[model samples]
Target: MSSTRFTDALTRLVDALPEPDDFPSTARNRELTARVGTWLGACFLLAFLTGVWSHLAQLPDPVLPLPTRPVWLYRVTQGVHVAAGTAAVPLLLVKLWSVFPQLFRRPPAVRRAQVLDAAERLSVLVLVSSASFQLVSGLANSAQWYPWSFSFRATHFAIGWVAMGALLVHVAVKLPVIRTAWLEPQGQPAQGTVSRRTVLGVTWAAAAVAVVTTAASGVPGVRRLSVLATRTGTGPGGIPVNKTAAAAGVARAAADPAFALVVAWGDTERRLSRADLEAMPQTTATLPIACVEGWSASGVWGGVRVADLVDLVGAPTGSAVLVESLQRVGASSRSRLPGNVAADREAILALTLAGEPLSLDHGYPCRVIAPNRPGALQTKWVSRLEVRP
Candidate 1:
């Protein structure tokens, strides 16, 4: 059809649709949307920064040198990442509800304005859909619920860029309107109907409650209050276990009497039994196991330093190592530790937690534990540590 014909048809359709004013309420004004969107946008921005740090932290070769000090960095960042996302849910819902009437509002009469209006709506669609997916998928990931076959980290990371891009476009397009609505006093509520203040107050309360109830999986202080938390930061040996020995299909291997930790550099190799590893000079470091699933807990890890193990194999300083687990499945069966990470004094091949032998579920004979690293990268049930040339 010609542009004119399409425009005429659209006008007729919009005319037949319910008018925005038909469902008017003081709570559903531009001011209300602006207020709620301010909070939603803040949440998204915070999640974006923390999420980027998380993705970079898990990379096999990070572009930048992630710090090894302030051991609780990842724990705090990932915790905030999940909490900000949780808080965004209610704010998004309220923002959308406040602007629901715009979905059926009549288009602009001027051709240029009409085109801009269409573009704005399209951007809004992308922003809302992507934001919703991020929140839902993030929540599912926190609960360890994966209904889809694709990698959650990869997909979530990619969509996050898309969502943020669309959000910028939306904000740019509506800046003038946002400024006006945000600065101006809210219009009074229709007599006998709820005020905009009440709506906003309730929405803020809901967001606060959401964050408090779910973010406890990562924050120890609020763990009790977070009854809805997925992981209570507690498991065998006082540290939560994401994958159990039996589930990883490594129970037999990890418990085998012949089990040995193979440390190799080039052609040189050293096989150490649990006794051998324990006999070596031991170091203790309190480090947090900060999982991507948004839970973390610190344990006093006691073991031989990774630097010592590499030195035994004749691996030089500033060398990276690939840690291999006994598990026969999953991408997490192996993880690469960079040069700086390996060199850090706080990095260890942990044999004990809280001064007790490591539990089978927590990597049995030995596991890799390092400060300021994601728990996934802290390879568990370690069988081999090969130094990279």
Candidate 2:
């Protein structure tokens, strides 16, 4: 069928169905529900737009330089993306409560009943499922736990498409209800007429407040005020590591002779020593430490670049660099060496933080810093380096 015919048929099918009066609630509830639906729709739309932009920014060699986009802009957009999604939780609950009663009202069969019913059911399922997953997964990712092996970015990207498609179908199906409710005040016996404009204004104001507050507390620039900052050492998997330890480790490593700071790549069987690293030319860069937890701090790091170190050893391009931590247990020494280092070109066995020597918590002897990767990937307390192909 032509697009116009399909839309016309769909609209007629929806129009032929029972109206709000056919359900159990008063007119007031219907109006309130419609108003809430509008708010939720607005939030969803904002989230969808920002989410697409953020994901597009991750594309390699994008038309625009996304990283160079002012850090504040990134923070605001990301904050909105998260805030809109969080607000949807309560809005969806209210919307579902208001509309659920309509499900019980039966209507006569119309043209393409099977197709319409199937399409409606499928759309609802996708909408609910995708929204639920995105909200839950986003919360988990923010907490820094990967429940699924799949990359969060990839899953988020795919589910965003599903959510958008489902949203379109839902809007198409509910067009009549939205129009009627929007045009006329909700008239009910118990509750007087509700001004649509008032409802919309209040909802928009609430959403704005939510977004602003959340962003202020959680984004990098304003994160100092966040309650979460006060609760340190509480990362996922009971990882005792915290920002304090991370900062201290980097400081202590530089001054302590026992601390070994170097990047090594090659067979784990053959270990590289501190002498080996000193022989290579070192480069220092003041890079900001950006973490997924919405915290960011700049640190001055000094180390032989993994690429340079690998070249000194004559290792292949694809060889993995191993980093070691000074912390040891029993006979075995603790280290992050021999890990995959080939993934980044600027990976470094950092020896300094913010121009000072490493602190105890910050990987005193040495730590690995690979730009654009998670903090966990940057191992602390360097002791050994091994290259692997």
Candidate 3:
């Protein structure tokens, strides 16, 4: 069949189904849709910006070096990322419900209008599908649940661009309608149970509740209010661990009496036993293990400064280091520390937490704890540090 004829047939089939008129509701007006959409867009923008920063922060060679001061920068950004994403869940549901009837909208009779309608429908499909996947998968990641085989980080990052693009297109197409809804007052109230104001108020409340309940994953101050928090902010040394020695297959190796941290640069090498490292200068830094999964807790970490370790191997200041873990598996088994980060006095191969010897689950032998670094890159169960100038 010809393209026009095919379009007409599909339109007829869709029009035959229930129309928007059949699902009348006062909350289904353009004004309410616009308002909900505005809030949802703001959430998406915030999530996208922070997600980009997070992805960059995790890269072996970040596009830009992330900040290393204030100590709690990543903690705040990641916290906001998770909280905004969590809030989007409820806002998305309400936005979809407000415009659910649009799915049954009939194609226009004119070919020109029909083409525009088809384009709008396509944009909406992309927007909804991408937005839904991002929010749902993000929640799963925050909860540490992985039901899919694909890499969440890579997939989420790529789809984020698509979602943002679709969102921009949608806003451009609906700008006139949105502007009208925002500037003009609503006309006579529709004959329905809930008012537009009621729907909007309820949606805002739901979003707020969602954020408050889950924000403890990152913000410890809100832990009491966050009953639904993913992590309780309680673990070894008063900090949560994403991976334990048992889970990472490093339990026996970490406890071995002969265990030593090998620091190497070129032909020079030094193997320092646990006691030997303790004898060296100890520096304590209060740093937050700000997880990308959206939880964090601060602890007083004491250990040999990473700068000192590299210095033993004849490496000069501003030299980067590759930290290897006893972890035989997983992407976090080894991580690269940039030069500036390695030179930071606050960067240490921590041996003690809260003035107590490190727990096995908390990297007994040693772990890299640096300011403003993602928790995953902290390199727990540290076994080797290869310095590079």
RMSD of each: 2.9, 10.3, 2.9
How high a TM-score does candidate 3 get? 0.95
- Across residues 1-389, which tens digit of lDDT does each residue of candidate 2 receive? 99999999998997787765666444335567777887788877888887787665434234543333232454456656777776787677657766776564444478688677766877887898897787778767656677788878778878988887888888889888788877985554554354444544555666556445443444445544444332332232212344444343334444555543443443323344455555667667655444443434445577667666566567776565554455433111332222233434456766556566555666655567655433444666666666656
For model 2, give the 10-residue run with minimal summed lDDT: 330-339
After the best TM-score superposition of candidate 2, give how far the Cα of residue 282 lies from its true spot, in angstroms: 5.2
Collision pairs in model 1: none
The candidate, 1 or 2, that scores higher on TM-score is 1
- All candidates in order of lDDT, best leading: 3, 1, 2
lDDT of 1 by residue, 1-389 (tens): 99999999998886788978887576677888888998899999999999999889989988787989899999999998999999999999999999888897888899999998898888999999999999999999988899999889899999999999998888888899899987775666667368888998999999989989888566656788898989777888799899999999999999998999899998998999999998999999999999988889989999999999889988897799999999867878999889999999999999999999999999989999999998889999999999997
Query: Weakest 10 consecutive residues, lDDT, candidate 1?
Result: 184-193
Model 2 stretches astray by more than 4 angstroms: 1-19, 22-81, 90-101, 110-115, 140-165, 171-194, 218-221, 224-284, 293-298, 315-347, 359-361, 379-389
335, model 2: CA deviation in Å? 14
Model 2, total clashes: 40
Q: Model 2, 2: alpha-carbon shift in Å?
A: 50
